[model samples]
Target: MEANLTPQQLWDCALRLLSRRDHSRRELAQKLRQRQFDPEWIEQALDRLEQQHWLADSRFAAVQVRQHVLKRHGPLRIRAELQRKGVGPAEIAQALAAEDPDWFELARLCYRARFGPDERLDMKERARRMRYLQARGFAPDHIRYALESADE
Candidate 1:
């Protein structure tokens, strides 16, 4: 509710949100504001959480990168998503670098899973497949390797 909230209640709400999943400080702040919590109270609650080490942008970014990679999303899409979540570029870069899954292999797997046997495709068919991979956020080199080098 957007009604009056004691500091404790605000902190409880933030803890509840964090219990479900990691959230950037900005995301937690935005959610509290949306609930009509007083801005000062929101800031206080966030600061307390940070002091308790219950909130961390770096941890949030790391989890996001791993999750997106597992979903077959490429680095570009993952980086953009992290940025949208208010993660700093340095944290995003560190998270991405840490995860560093074999992107080329991932692209190949995604291509195989989506298109099945890489039958000798005509130029038009190849182009269409290439478009699909690109939309999935794969780099051009990875896409080319997947389409050309994947077993027929």
Candidate 2:
């Protein structure tokens, strides 16, 4: 992949990547740069793609949020992940707002699935699970609610 790409070649490569899935402008730019396209070429190609509505950070953020939720991740973790992926704060907020109201329920389901239905973990065990969920980007309130509801 060391060959120099003409402007058209760069554009084609960008489209090939975008056609597979949405990508944040930053993500696409980084990918193009990694392919050794000139910085100027990468910028111009990205601009053209944006003009054609092919690359959209907001769309990428929304899809990422949905996918993370489906994978049993909480809002906190998803938001951080999206931010790290170069999603803007406003788009991240919108994505989080669009997430399911039953997100807490899903987390509870995931917890039960992982630890089994036995809610008899001692205080230390309970705290350890709580810490695990926390590190996974779940809010304390959501984790607490899930643990309590599961106990019931």
Give me the candidate number with maximum lDDT.
1
lDDT of 1: 0.87
TM-score of each model, in listed order: 0.91, 0.91
The models' CA-based lDDT, in order, is: 0.87, 0.84
lDDT of 1 by residue, 64-138 (tens): 999998889877778888888899999999999999899898999888888888667788988998898888888
Quote the lDDT for 121 in model 1.
Answer: 75
How much lDDT does candidate 2 score?
A: 0.84
Residue 137 in candidate 2 has what lDDT? Answer: 74
The residue pairs found clashing in candidate 2 are none
For each predicted model, how many residue pairs clash, with residues at least 3 apart or on different chains?
A: 0, 0
Error of 2 at 76 (Å): 1.0
Per-residue lDDT of 140 in model 1: 93
Q: After superposition, how far is residue 73 of candidate 2 from its true place, in Å?
A: 0.6
